[model samples]
Target chain A: MKIETKVEKFTEPLHLESGRILEEFELIYETYGELNEDKSNVIVICHALAGSHHVAGRYADEAKPGWWDKFIGDGKTIDTTKYFVICSNNLGSTFGSTNPLSIDPSTKKEYRLKFPVLAISDVVKAQMRLYDRLGIKNAFAVIGGSMGGMQTLCYAIEHPTFAKHYLAMATTAYTRPWAIAINKLAIESIRHDPIFKNGFYKKDDLEASGLPGLAIGRMAGLIAYLSPGLFNRKFGRDYASTDGLYELFGRFEVEKYLEYNAYSFPKIFDPLSYLYICKTMNIFDAGRNKDKLADSFDKVQGKLHLISFSDDMLFFPEEMEEIRDIMIELGKEKQVTYKMIDSKCGHDSFLVEVEKFKDYVSEILKD
Target chain B: MKIETKVEKFTEPLHLESGRILEEFELIYETYGELNEDKSNVIVICHALAGSHHVAGRYADEAKPGWWDKFIGDGKTIDTTKYFVICSNNLGSTFGSTNPLSIDPSTKKEYRLKFPVLAISDVVKAQMRLYDRLGIKNAFAVIGGSMGGMQTLCYAIEHPTFAKHYLAMATTAYTRPWAIAINKLAIESIRHDPIFKNGFYKKDDLEASGLPGLAIGRMAGLIAYLSPGLFNRKFGRDYASTDGLYELFGRFEVEKYLEYNAYSFPKIFDPLSYLYICKTMNIFDAGRNKDKLADSFDKVQGKLHLISFSDDMLFFPEEMEEIRDIMIELGKEKQVTYKMIDSKCGHDSFLVEVEKFKDYVSEILKD
Candidate 1:
């Protein structure tokens, strides 16, 4: 636990829906940009999986802009100079934000597995608090990528007054059976891990599921991050280098990179945070409304832009078309438009393949 | 551990450049075509990773052809009526071949990790025995795809007298750094798995490194097998379902397809065999016969047709040009030709992109 006592929380006593009372829930967040005098020029930027409120500015160090650092800089997509951009590290974030890893206050111990299951609404509610605190009556835009996109869609429906412009990037409204299987396998790798000790073990157990599970989980996530061709280009069948010809036993260089990356992740991310985030993704159902997503879209009063990657396997383009179709059926087609960017990098291409992503971002934010 | 008591050894201790002794080895092979009366028309059809000897015949429930069933059938690439075709599983294989998991006469238990690393030469030697069994005095051609291509190059260099025509299809003479990296990661996944127990564990330990390692390993290999854009085009972040709901649960159809494929891989592959095959590829070097590759007209005694894909990240078109330069330098450009096929499917396209793989095969065979 790298302590960040600076975190503040607001409790929402209970929001009953899924049969369990999410009682006295403490939600945490962080922000960027200044609130305009009118507070109407607000742009809420949602973070994707492993994202946080620290989208811009320093978080103790010379923090590089956010993960979307390139898109949300000065005079860029979410130009801070023209708009008040508000971002939050969702309630279940592993960042300094409140999460399952946070102390329960009642027990004075970390929540761990005892934390209540969270829905996307929980995160939406958390942001609502920040909106209430800042006295913001409406948002200029609510933009996000991947899981952040899910939030953008949810916010537009759950609280239409908050977002006038909605941008969902590389996101799906719900988890697919295939995606769930991979997540399940990853979670199994963690839970069945010998070190997990049924999630009751002390935090120091590295040999257990924490590192290995995080490593495997990240690997699975990492696979989703890039295109198959990119990996093949980066690492072909070349073996690790050897100083001497006689060295028979040696690894290839690419192997070293994954190992190093997987090893470091466990330290930075909590197992419980991963669980909550995945659960949030799994439980997301915008179509649960009476008319399903069509009704959900009917409630939203915003210009919806659904941008997807041609190479994103995690959220295939077909599903996005489904979302677009539903919105269009609800007479939201003019407000809802979709574009597919071509790239060989798969899901992560939005974050990588910078020039392509940059062009799209600029086009969307163009005056 | 599916017992096949009929496995036979080649009855020769293969001598390799590396002093490591592979006590004895065997060849798992299938044959097609007929040898010419002069024994001058023998063609060796090499198979890639995860391929087998049942190239074109009915082997139990697997009806289709063997690995290259179409390319070497009645009127295929190496037409049986015109040449003798031999497809042999590599020495360190698990497909009804002498592999690491086979029972070690010395220890009584399956050799598992104790199996000595085998090389491309070992695969060649095993094939040579099958050739000798069929009394092949000279070969008309040696052909393969991907890993099979690596073997084709190795066979050409080691026994110049055996292969006079080399049709190297979408293969690299040497495994590049990228391929090695991906494979190393796959291997590392297995080696780090405690269930593997450093390559040996109780037979009952079904949930060991082999499952996840093999699953991820094979899936990782898929990076080389398909184009990034194709996956994206088919799946791009489409939600996991056709329903307009967003429940943070489950996966998409394409993911389910991949899982279905990966599920069968662990059962069919041996962890140590995967490790050893990589070692063979790592030691692989086609630079040994630079003169022959460079000057197809000079010292070279065989006809060369090197084919590559424009979108292939593993074996780039630039590499095919490298092979072409050698032929051009030797003034054997006419004897050695090269072509880059346009495709959206990556490396594995050579196998599934039949019309393309077949056209090249037919063209090469005709000349």
Candidate 2:
């Protein structure tokens, strides 16, 4: 069931760490539940790649509920009755936030590629301004998975005193070579398209971005989502038939699923947006930011819950263990806990797998 | 030192098991060493995808040496002084063999895609005829890797008494789902190319049947020829610094290798010829012809040597072991020896890995 939530547009001119001032920084967000008298029940929900502020409910008359609606209802993991939840579209996101498609006040045109390349830290920093404006001193917990997990770590490292708990799920501290390679291929798919005009094309021409090139992008993403065991389970050279006509007709169900994903991406996503967001995500490195792992975690004043997935090849389970190991070395062991969720969905288990993730969430939050 | 070999062409009209008469089946081949008195020293080397009869030494008056020059000459593992070696370009191959690009006796024009869709067995059948015509009673070994490996297995199954040794490398009894999936994508790359014309385009346009498609095809092949460890070792997301002034460059040396292979293929290869040859290789199945594994090997003339490389994601080591296990089951255990090469090069180790392959050959010959 879709929960009811309130959304309001809050615009504030914020000074960036860079000397330049974003004169009209705007934030779009949705909120659920009531704040306690001491405001200690406030929980922050962060998003991974391609997520928006619509976290738990129907936006007034919209039929489609939020992406995380399954996990944020009254009795869900992020229970609305116990915690006041807030989710916002980060500043550089194409969702409701001011992004490349936003008009620059000085030039009065879409920033497009002209928008300054954003880092996850920059995104987190912008959200901090939103938090300050909302009078939230510290969130009871900051929880996220995948790219959102990266943002949670960045927030905790940057403003540890303001975060009581940090739960990171199925994420890496920084992007790796394999992921960057896939990202490069994905971006190249769009840029090399005959009609892709480097983001200046009209909205009508933008639809072409999803055809063959974007289809390949979705394919690349699918590879990271599923496990080899899944592939083995589904199709093991069991052809449709022996006449050479059956395999010719349709053999592997995996191929059909990939085609579906490729066909669907263009309707919901823009190629340029994918490019920009990928770059921002890649440059996000908390250890690099603070010079060392210990230094990065030292500033954190929050409990860290580092969660990994057994089948997450994109962000390997070993990487998550490394993060936990680092937190221990930094003498923050008391504030840290590591949980691993075993699933066959690989990197995409966080989003695609429901029941298993729900059970894991229940166990993690029980204490 | 390079050993000179005589090259010649032979043609014969053969009746296929399919009840179709293959008339004037032309074969271009090279032979080294004098035939033994009993025609029993013959070692036939089957070519893999896109390879030819020039297994050793350069063509007469040619600038470039043959593919396996380092391992196939004089006192090599096969030992030309004691053994006669024959390498014939497979039928349906673009190399100087009877192919779609060759003139059809019926039409006088290139057969194009009209060439009978071939199976791996067909190629072996034609080679067997070549053997019979040459007055060879037995082959010392039928050795090959990849598609060539398919032929080795086919030779063993189809004429158990003719080939005494089956040295199959980097191949399977049948094409697995992973290989078929990649091959299907490559075919789609060629078929969906606007210039393909469903195999009935203008003669000049037929040249365009698969240019850019060559990229995807070779890219897929390159994946087979590489190990993930080797690719990660060699590439690891290293990229050329473009400075945003020119088109993006390939991310890794391996990617560049694939691009070069892709570009090279379209320059020389006939699109229809590629399709026919790959299709033959894809459907190659020794397992399909016989019910039990022993029934499949019951016809094999002699010993079997199965070789695989470590870290070969394409022809996974697991599949190679399966063939070896089957060979051991039927009291042919003494005749079958399996060796897994410890190399990071993966399946391509068969080609670029000269010293190791040569050593293995010497060791096997000593046995």
Candidate 3:
């Protein structure tokens, strides 16, 4: 399927969880298939930190299909042919959304760090506004993974009667110390970059000199994205260059891979957006009331599916199990389903190892 | 067990595996208790990255004891009262021994990147030289962990009859892609630092402005050092400061912990030495020849004990298991032993969770 992104402008002020405000904003989104007469077959896809509205199909000149093209599209697991699928570039993301890179109306300059620190719930609220403008009352499902999964849980809790099903993959009910530590390293890397200029560096300047620190941060993130087993099997102890072993700055095959992907990231991503998105993830707490995690599920009116990968170091299966256990204790076990996918792809299993989750998704969405 | 580091100067040039030469060097070491008449009860301890020769006891003005003081003392696990314990600073380490910070006699300047990329065996050979100068032919055991473990294996392999027991803890047979990827991030962080000045920055300047990039790199290293389970239980999702949750650059309890430790690292350690040591670790392969891992063990003349932590993300149990499997296939299983310690401290379990391994160590060394 071919895809085209559409933008919607919202003039209303968005009051964030932290009491910060986004005076006005725009939401860029893409839709697959067609909305049913009553819009009962709507499926909202919440994108992860780096993901955007382009969830399926390709643009006219694009080389690769959308990020989740395999899992979406016609007759696929998500089955966009039968259900209208809508994916929006998150509010704090750099992907065509009114993010830190967007010009501020008041100062007529880039928002940069002036952009309000967003919560996962704030992004969900923005998506909710988009749905309101699109004349949708309720949706069949809200599905996402990682940070997207966090948004899914926030949406389900904040709007208990919206979606019929909430499928959160490889996520946690709250940000833990382990995940926060990783996020800290990434944010610290960007903060340490000389060219970052306290998040005020010109985009062109960053592109030319390169955000080497950001690239390094990306390398750290990439390491956590996949499992050690996969890395050992794929790259092993191979040297990228013949004389790498003999040189102090020698490039291992894995180093080369990380560098290529990491360096390329700065060109497409804004450091401020990356930082803000990471903070949003760092502060994401579905059950903000610490001791009332079970109470948060009391009013849930949808089937909550918590899917996790066995080897996901970022969001361990045990985290999802904790959430499942909480729901079970709350007498909502019937409404909550926890599935652990035996995968060797770590956190990215939701993206790269979709084949393992395809049949599960197909079974769940059969109706 | 009062410890004082002693420096030994070597006038003879040392040949390195990378075909580079150290015109002359020094080995700094610390000894505890007395050496037996025949020198048969001597135990040589190999220190890990960032570790030092002072492995036990306290110095005159020291606030804390040595890194492994808990494991080695008058009546401790290693039993310094009965056996003489010697811990030597590795060749490329920042602590006392000849390193990148040391002046190159030829140019009369710090070696910096000019320091040869050392193989683990090169360090073992230097220790061998240290042993030769000390008039020691063999020892009771050679014990180490992490990078030190690599040295233990290299020493055991290179000098087959050097020690009766080779105890290598929480290390890999060779550096894999997962490890190389992590090292790349750390190395990239230092290289990306604007203040790094291509490894020619004045030491005073680095100390003044601080190596923010190095600190960031240290944060990454620190994250890999401990298990996620420990982080969850220790730091949880608590905020370091009351206003942290509301601010974009807010600090979580975990972030604060990482920042405190990571930022402090640059004050004590040199970035150049870290780079060289990381390179050493990346290139460490017990068997450099492909498909000859087993062959590298052919001349083994001592009992090899490979100890691993169950949750060590840096070096997994499977890695040690692979080595044990190789020994078993070669009918040398009787000579090689593999022990897995159940601990939540990850790779640092060898240093932090000593109680769990104390009985095992005591039992093995009873003879």
Candidate with the greatest TM-score versus the true structure: 3
Per-residue lDDT of candidate 3, residues A1-367 (tens digit): 4355799999999998888788899999999988999999899999888888899998779999889988999888888778899999999888888999898888998888888889888999999999999999999999999998998898788898999999999999888888888888779898878788898786778766367767777788898888898898889888888988888888988888898999998878888888999999998887785467777767688989889999898999998999889888888878888899999889999998899999998777665
DockQ of each: 0.18, 0.23, 0.85
Clashes of each: 51, 2, 0
Docking class of 1: incorrect
- Model 3: DockQ against the native? 0.85
On a 0 to 1 TM-score scale, where does candidate 1 land against the true structure?
A: 0.76
Best by lDDT: 3
- Chain B TM-score (each prediction, in order): 0.87, 0.90, 0.97
Candidate 1 residue A261 C-alpha distance from true site, Å: 1.2
TM-scores, all candidates, are 0.76, 0.81, 0.98
lDDT-best of 1 and 3? 3
Clashes of 1: 51
Cα deviation at A339, candidate 2, in Å, is 5.2
Worst 10 residues of 2 chain B by lDDT: B242-251
lDDT for A352 (candidate 1)? 63
- Global lDDT of each candidate: 0.68, 0.70, 0.87
